[model samples]
Target: MTDHHDRPHHDLIEHPRPRFAPWLVEPMLRNKGTYLKVALAAAMINIFGLITSLFTMTVYDRVVPNNAFSSLIALSIGLAIVVVFDFVLRVLRAYFTDLAGADIDHDIGGRVFRRLVAIRLDQKKGSTGALTGMMRELETLRDFFASATMTALVDVPFIVITLIFIAILGGAVVWVPLAAIPIVVGAGWLTRPALDRLSARAMSEGLTKQSVLVETVGALEMVKTSGASRLLGQRWTRANQQHSDSSTRQRLVSTIATTVAASANTLAYAGTVVVGVFLIADHQLTTGALVACSILSGRAVQPLATIAALLSRLSATRTAYKQIDAMMETGSEEPRGTALKPARFDGRIELRGVAFRYPGAAEKTFDGLDLVIPAGQRVALLGKVGSGKSTIARLILGLYQPQEGLVMIDGTDIRQYDPHAMRSLIGTALQESVLLSGSVRENITLGRPGVDDAEMLRVAELTGTHGFMGRIANGYDLVLADRGEGLSGGQRQSISLSRALAGRPQLLVFDEPTSAMDQTTEMQLIDRLQTELQGRTFVLITHRPALVRLVDRIIVVEAGKIVQDGPRDAVLQSLQRPRTAA
Candidate 1:
């Protein structure tokens, strides 16, 4: 095999992330008529509130002063009707808003997952924890939008009605509410940038803490064994404190904004009444009209007032969107291949100038590598640590793309094949057996299903997992914890071996599978591999030279380049040389 030994190259074209979240917007508009009806109902209720104020001021200012007894009795019935109408509208809005929220949540959540799954590798590589946060943020968004949107929608027509009523009763007098709007907006504007800063800090720290907590729990065993539990706890505590500090600062900004808003509303309300009273005293306006003008002022200020209170919250969520946008825009190591499904893979693997550098890595993992193995060939790869042996294995498995050149099967570029289809051709059992959270049978039959008890038993015995599997209470039905926490390393590896063979793949890639096995178990596995894997190609990366004799050939890699390659006998003879080693 030819070897490449120099230079670094990492360039491949990529598509940009999407800018819109259509999945969410589409569903919100699905029941437009219902939402409109709800808005109309709410408008009616708000109109009643405006009318009530008009009637109250008109009654006291005109009827009471005039000693009109019958006007008071008519006022009671008007007030009663307003109460009943408002109550009914409130209930209807609640029911419809809840129904809408639930439907949007389901549709958007599913689309979010689909988007997440289809996210290009480059898009998944940055401060990627935000994807998890997006799940929660989107749900919270649905809740907020459901309430805020309906109210905001309802306020538009309701607000216009009050303005018109005031104009007819007191010309140009309704401007009081409009005047207060700028003040409310100005107050929020002053605090928006500051709140954004605090919000960014708060969200970052909160997500970091969540990630740390999840990692600590997931690696509880390793943490305990390494005496690093205290380290994780300290980090978690510090994260919590930082989050608290950010939130407190945010609250302080909000408090100031809210105080300023209240002051503005108070001054505006006082000014409106003062203006109305002056007009009344001059006999230019009636007391009844003054009352109606006051009602209109209240209606205009309501939306602005509510907006002032929600200012901090809205800024924080927008800041959160910044983080989310980063995740959606992140780039990852570009793979040459698409998801593939090949009908027949002869299992001839090849590498050409293969090189790799992990995401955000300052230095490359390996470079200038080349190797090849024909179909049905068993090749043992041996090397020192950091020698690019495992990297080569992964390259062959199509998990990592080579930046410099290419990895191929049967001289066909791996990138041209569908990712899943290509991967289906190879079965892998790494040093760390990633046993999923499921029953033994489920784990064994992961890559390929449709296995009956008899077939499962056959695979179990073949991979030396039958004895332990049978010992479990429910045999293949015994549920395993995440990563098979309760199982010994040997047991886990055996089950993983079964999983590899379950699909009966043509190409088996074993990355030091015997790392945790005892000598007897290792020897047995080697024998089984030799017998059962006959006619199947295998790439075994291992440190033990003892097993090098089991394969038909040996390849020694160093510094991402192949140093030695030959037939088993030839490599062994070279190793025995007095002054040199293969």
Candidate 2:
């Protein structure tokens, strides 16, 4: 189950504020107070760590040499008190760190998802599987900030203070751990480029594998019918193998760095002891000081080693951050500033000198195309495939913006109005109808709280949905599987058509809406819509001749140009006239 806080409220998307920082950075910065508290706890905890070393030194030098049991007991009691306080501080540090991370998670995760939904369709990049993989990277980023990795990072600065203490107490021996610091840091640094490269390769392969898996599952029936399993399976196998190899190499490099750091820590401790013993022989250092020096040397380099071990995680996090950041930076569909929220549009659509081509297309779908759709005008766009008939519907619906001209609703530029508000007034059912996993009523109403049972059934009856829905045991309550599984293509179209009418929209645009229905159902739907579309602006794009009954005007398009425009009967008569070769 998802947490309530992770869901972005509707108002957040409807009224977004200007972003000052990267989407993830702002949330972490917002919880700076908690991070500050965690920092303070870390400082106190590191300071308390010195107590153990000091106590050991005092026991060996003062208590043992002087045979003072009373002094030892007092030192032991003081050490116990410090230990208790230190434990509490460590626990508090962990709690504060987690609290800050949770706050960031709640804010940034929801905002990222919101951005994904609001981003312009033209700005979308990558396949569905790749996008999903990128989204999952959020968890890796959150874990980096919230886990023990951050704690290790915070402890690094304290290594300097530890070195200072060692220098003061075990003179000449402090140089040993200090010399090892550069070696440990350098080893980890040297492997970074390799680790980063491997991480990126692994991430890419993982995304590809995910894409193949999603595609296979989404179109399993088609894949089986078309004998594509062997091809897709080979692609999946290749991606998986490549990902595994890259991951293994990445881990190996990271392990080598960690192993070097660990070895340096041990060598630093041993080198300190070996040097301290010589000083002891020369009466320059005491046994107690030597022991204390060894303990402090280990503590100093331990953070460095932990940091080395975390290098791979850091690399992966960086890769994830770059991808997610790019996704969040895409252009959003929401208009800037306080956009007009008109209660309704008069349903007048116009495209003036419009030019457009899809992303990565070789030719323009429209060039200097000018057309106007009057309020309550029922028009049919007649064209063969690839003749830009459906493109006209999409442009009017504001699904895609023309590069060179304006799409106006009610004589006002569509860009000036809130996209949600403008689109709400236009009922759209595309060529491919998609139904989510939900009950029939839920799909019809689409979670609109204001829609009642009467409005739902009325639309269902008009769209001929009642004919098939009545046979289902659950009727309007029937639950659908993913993409309306277990239902025929015609049934899905009926449900989709019903949803379009459920809104009582001012404008209706459908492309091949009845392509999947039988002749009887198609005629019945056309009859019902002929009456239902009384005052609505209707734009129909279809190849079927029977649907002509719903429109009063006919416009024929060829190669992005309007070849003919007139009353329905005249256009039909012109089309039927025999043409002589010139």
Candidate 3:
């Protein structure tokens, strides 16, 4: 609730260090306990994994050469017990890994969603497709944590254990695996630059393709009406091709790295066998020891090979993590302020010496503009298409803050009030009606707690939405398509109006609310709205002259400056007056 602007001049001059590093680490810290448990389980699993080579050595050296059947039986039973216990540990390790991955998914997903919702409207413009793709990247990270790649990473340290065991069984032959370790790791390292570049390009191309498809789907009506389907399809095809090419390149590089690592391990095993044969001939080592040394060499190099195979996925996951981290750090909206909450209040709006501009515009949208509306009065804002009328409404709604000046509601600065509480007192319906896929009753109630059936039906009747509800088979229970696709424009607008009115807000703002309606429907809706909005303050932003008559006063804005403000009749007469000479 602290006003950032109220900080001292010296404080404002000081630049704070970036907080992104800590923000990135916060989620990992939250799941530290689960990660620790997974690590412990992995260590145990790796320790038990050595049993295979140990059992082979014992059978060949102790049982086979001695013709000891009883010893063989005992060894088989003991090894069987070890194998069963190892299997259980592996299962537990996988379970814990999955548990940790799920926790991270839930935690990170919720955090990102909350931040996305709270971001300023201006900041979110035109990035819908990219944002959607970023959300999907979270799934990529979740899968990475749960995949065999993660298991290999955990087992990487156990490579040392395998090498040490080999050295103990056969001296100096272990040097072959020791020599191959650098080759295995170096192959992966050498391919990293290519993998990073290709993976990054592929991710960019994939997001572009996704964005095109999302845009096409969202504006299908426009594409159909304007005959742009072919153009859009061709554009998507190009994007898809680029994405596919990048993916192919990335896969090729990853495959080469994996092959190199695997080949190195194979060569190391061959070297160990040749050396062990010489040692056996010289009476320096046993045949069982040679077998154990080969097995241990493979184990020593397997982790590096696994890592090489997973390089592409790891690179993609790294890119996603960095992108999400930057978004949360810089793109998220500031926290809301703490302010008093009131049940209801008179709707008095004031804008004092306001100066504003859109995010990327060169010119100001408004400069030194001032306006005042008394409580419980209806007013209309008349302006041309791009004259900043809608911008004013957004400011009043607290969706955007003025670059300079103050916007007050009921004598208190809007910034000083709890934004949610302030918005709850106002109702709005825009030109484009937004409706989610749900039943008719659900759309009307909008999850408001105390809105009973009667209240919902009452608002429906008030907005004339009930007229179409009865035509549908399920009445209030009738399901709607995504974004109200099945309904006519007027029907959609009516439902949106019903939703706005259901709240009975003290202040009602409509921005060309009836733009989609036919003339007759528009007039009927205006008449009904007039009665429903009685005793409440209303602000209508519209170009229609007919709609202006419903308001008590009219304010004309030209070039972001108010040209005229007076009673409804006076303003109308002035606008109607014919000019003889310029």
Candidate 4:
């Protein structure tokens, strides 16, 4: 085992150039036709918007001035039709925009989850809180697509159309509203530095707080037993306070930008009105046209204010997008190799000149170590703690690659075999039992197809799990909480053992598998396991001498080297002898 502090601080696998996020791109492309519909609807809506000014111009300058009642009636009907068309277009755009957003949300959400699961377990270390935060950030992106921000972005281009129309209505005076565009835009831009600073701080503090909470909850028993609940609470509260403070600052900056944009819009509208009045007095514009210019100026500035209002969400979403992209681009676990359908392993394991040091370790765990366990042999690895007993088991399982030399299965390099296929043929039960949230049958079978009730019950009975399952109301259907929370330590271990044996694997590796059991229960389990594992290749890693009787051979490891290896009787005799003084 490697010391935690000395372990390498970077990914063991390197990646090429950053990979593109299909989640972000695919959704947009899939809904491109819908987006096009929305855009066309928006364009129609804006075109109809011009009807207001035109209606005003005609009513004031033509109908009202001439007192033509029939003209007024006819014009009012035309205006009503335009208003109805505009309303319908607005609703269609909103509906289609939301539909497109839903499609994007569904697409990206599934892909991100799958990616998170597929990444190597080593790569996920210390990232639980960040991953949780990233998941929420994904929601932010989904909501952004459906949000008014999208509408504002789409409407922004229509400002050009609005300006073009306004120019025709009120010629040179159009400059008043056009000049105000930069002022509103600059106001939004100026706050970005502040927004970025505060948002980053807030996100960092938020992840810290979440990490602490998850760690504390996961180890609640330890915290309570150790009397460190208050300390944990203080740590969480401090992180929360920092997050809240940063969030407050972020909101303040966003608000100021929004207010500045609104003020600019108001000023622009006022300027257009005053300037248009002068143009009308100079006989360069009609009375109705002056009024129309004010309306057009307001329409043009609205999108900028909306965008300013959405700045905070945009900033947060941008940060999240970058984080997700980086996570996806990071190298995944080693490939499963080309040996898709490997031959059944005979379980003849060998290691030659195998030197292994964990990443960033100051010294190797072992150097030039050689060992062989022939097919159909039952071997016990006896060693003191930290003597690499468990490391040997992991190496055999291909959980971690050796830094030097080769780990061979049968006569071939284990790396040449497909990892998934290799693992399927080996059964392992570790010192710490792990059980997921599922029914007893599901946990035992563990997604192994073709495992039926009789096989499940046989393994369960052999591991003594059937005894407890009979007591539960649902029997094999009884559901367990995550980590087997409702079961006693011994019961959990039994289920873990049952899971290992359920698939009838060719290789069985047990590391302190009976640690949680009482003496009587341990003896019973060993007897049953010994008979069950008779013809299979079995490796037992244990400190208890009682377990040595199950194996035909014994090996003792000390200080990163094999100190003793012999038939069971010879090793037992050597162990019984007194140690000499140093």
Candidate 5:
């Protein structure tokens, strides 16, 4: 009977992300037919080994002892040859199977990484670590099975075929004992539902533990500051314990399956012996035939016993395959654009009644907004929080498309231009920016190749970063920490300016770029930007009203609509009058 509570628990747990595993399909299809050939070859190899063993029965069956020296020597050599060939066949099969399996894993990981890159930030926001686990560690287990480690699918049938050979040579009565095979198979079938559940739970708990550890490590500072170290430790312990419990349930099913098969083996062997003893009394069975049947039957039991265990493992691999498939099949957030490269600089932009709402959000962020900037014009964006300031920046960057109207650049709709191409046209120093782990030189000039050494030093000097960076141990060669954690906020911003300016873009955007710097540094940085970026357009989003002198125009937005728009002087006089806090 199904437990209703457990039913929903299993039903609710999802695979990392859904996509078809297209990468795995080609190699899998190539290796798909190899198993058939392997099975046939193995059966022939085993049959020879069986014939070698059966030859011993001829000695026992003969009335006069027929153990001549030459015959004994030849028989010994033949048996040795058969044993050696059997070992070689087994080893070769394992090697080829493992190779096939590794290829499948490679394909799965490749597809996982590629699909993850295309998934939208919102859809994949919650499963970073789980996605990593699915691509890397979890799929390793699946590799073993994809390689066809379920040799039983082939091996079991071979054993069945061997039984047919013996049953035909001997009497039809001998096959009565072989009926135990179905009994073992039946018991295994009964355990399938439980086994499937156990296997899926095993995978889920393992991935959960992996996700928790990764999350904990990422938030170690938060855990320390919040005094939740003990709580996190307990959570870690509990996760591992749950994983153990789930794995044990899987093992429990495996144990039952193995035991049932083993018991059936014993029953079949006993039945064969009992029937043979009676047949011997009736003079219906020869010692040679009886011995041959016993040997073949005994040899067959080992594989049948292992079948249940192999099937259980195969079930687990199937679960992992589905997870991999789900990620590969997911829809992409943006269609890839044909890459466009630039030859020169010209900056112009126009927005006509453009408006947008974020997916799943309750309200729109913009309503019929209209604006235009001629070549090389400097514009300032002023807005309170949630007034669609950041969203406007995203829309200009083509991170999101507007719902109502068009955004054009140089008289053409921006969407028709390549997204990657637009990134090169704009040089941006962001408020909450990240510096990748590498030398200072590598961090700067990140946008453009063929950056001259002189140009790097010039950009750094222009941004006021040269003063501090020169004092560091190795100057510009000093490697930043991951995310630039070792650097101060102001220093990071300066470096960001150097990196952005290195591109020599037609348009410059500073999203609160000077917010971290002191008044003296901010003044110098803004002056340098004004001089070096003389012909470039600018979108300066800042809280410092003192810096308003650098821009030609100002627009203030409130509640997703433009409250004010005019020359910088006019807007400033209006804003200076003052108002109460929200």
Candidate 6:
């Protein structure tokens, strides 16, 4: 094969970009009718909010001074009715708001999870902990929608209505609350830059803290064995300190803004009263109208004060939206509308001048490499660690794409095949086995819908898992913990092997499959595999001499090049020959 040390060149695949809309906006738009209901309720609520002042004015100016007892009773009853109506409307607004929030949560939460599952492995950024933190931000977004933030936002526009009422009732004194509006808003605005910085720092430190915690818990055994507790503890302490400090500073800034807004509210009420005193002295305004002015002024600034206090949460929610949006926009592994029709693969593998390197690696694992394994052929890749043995298996499975050339199966490029359908017909066992939480039968079947117990038992027997299943009281019903935590290494490997074999696959790729087994177990597994793999294409990657029996041909790779290839026994003889000094 001609080696090309230069990087492989291929035209970039241009995917048609889908028109993007803000995720939060899109969901709300879909639920517009529900939001419209909330808005109408809020409008009615604000109109009803005027009832108290109006009732106070009527009682003080008309009923009390005129000694109209029947009039007072009638006004009281009317006021009581208005109060009930206001209460009902508020409740309805909250209900509709929460209903809309629920709909959004369902849609966005499902989309986030689906994106996480479908996103291309190479497109994924950040550590698992960071990703987890980003996923948690969805809760922040949902809470912002469901909390008082929405109410405050909706109520803000009604400040104009309140102002109009104040102008009509209190005349020139309307400017008192109107003047305070900007002061309250500015208080929140002035501290925003610092608040934003603190918010971002707090979020960053929070993710760091989450990362440390998750890392420590996931590797608790390793930390204990390796005496890494002190190091991890120090990291945890530092992250906690940073997070706490950022949070404290953030709250302090937020408190300052809230205090200013509250003071503005109080001053607006006091200012209104002070101005009304002059008008009262001149007999230009009545006591009842002055009292009504004070009440309306407070109402006017209440939403402003609320919005000021909620600035911190809004900032946090904004930060969260950006993070989630970035994650959602990542390229999916299976691109939409681009997947080829499913094709039956005959397991004839070929790598034509293939060149590949890992995402961030400095050196290429394979450069201009050529290899072929005909249909129904059994082959073993024998190489030292880091000699491109496992990389070959990954390429054949299309887990990673080559930077140049093609990896073909049955004279067709593997890239052109639908990944799901292609993988379903192949049995793969890696060097490290990972088992999910489930019973042995479920793990073996792996949620493949049509796999019955007969098929399950057949694979279990082939992988020698049937022996252990019989020993356990529950047989195939034995429940395994996450990552099979409670199981022995050999047992975990057995379960993994059984899963790979469950579908009676046409192609088998076993990488160090017997590494965890004892010599007797390995021998039995090899015997069973040899018989089971009849007429099937098999590729075995291993350093163990015993596994050579499973393949009729062997290829040895070194430093990204094939150094030896021949009949299995001949390759073994060549390897056994002693190296001579120059």
| Model 1, TM vs. native | 0.81
Per-residue CA lDDT of model 6 for 1-582, tens digit only, reads 112222111101112234434666789899889888888888888887798898898888998889999999998899889999999998998898899888999998988898887676555666666778878888998998877767787899989989999999889999999999999989999988888778777887887787788878878889999999999999899989989999999999999999999999999999999999999999988889999989999999999999988998887776677667767777766635677755355778999999998777778999999999999899999888999999999899888788998998888887777778788889999999989888988889988975789999888888889988878888888888778898889989999999998877888899988898998999999898888888889999987789899899999999889999999999888777765321
* lDDT winner, 1 or 4: 4
Give the range of the ten consecutive residues with the poorest summed lDDT in model 4. Answer: 7-16
The clash numbers for all candidates, in the given order, read: 11, 0, 0, 1, 9, 0
Q: Which of 4 and 6 is ahead in TM-score?
A: 6
lDDT of 1 by residue, 1-582 (tens): 111111110000112235534554588778676687777777777777777877777786867888887887788787888888789888888888777777777876676565565455422432333345555566556666566666665675565777777777777566776677788778889998899778777776776676677678778889999999898889889988988998999999998888877776776666678888888878877777776677667777676667777778777656544444444444333234554468878889988777677555566777766677999999998889988888777777666666788889988888777766676667888878989998888888773644566767776897789877777678888899998999999999898888777657888898887788788887776776677778888888998766665589999887767788999889777767965643
lDDT of each candidate versus the true structure: 0.73, 0.86, 0.81, 0.81, 0.72, 0.85
Using Cα atoms with residue i matched to residue i, what is each candidate's TM-score against the true structure?
Answer: 0.81, 0.92, 0.92, 0.89, 0.81, 0.91
Residue 171 in candidate 3 has what lDDT? Answer: 94
Output the number of the TM-score-best candidate: 3
Report RMSD (Å) for each prediction in the order shown.
5.7, 6.0, 5.4, 3.7, 5.2, 5.0
Candidate 4 residue lDDT tens string, 251-319: 999999899888988988899989988888899999888888888898888888888888878887766
Q: Candidate 3 on 1-582: residue-level lDDT in tens?
A: 223222211111112235435544666677677677777777777776677787788888988999989988887898888878878877887887788778778888888887777677555523456667777888988888767755787789999888889999999899999998898788788888888777667777776777778879988999999999999899799989999999999898888888889899899899999999999999999988999899889888888889888887887777777666655654433435557676786999999999998776778899999999999899999978898889889899888888999998999888777766777778888778999998888888878876788889888888889887878777989888889897898899898888888868889889988888789878887787777777888989998777876799999988899999999999888887765333
Candidate 6 ranges beyond 4 A from true positions: 1-22, 341-344, 579-582
TM-score of 3: 0.92
Residue-level lDDT for 483 in candidate 2 = 96
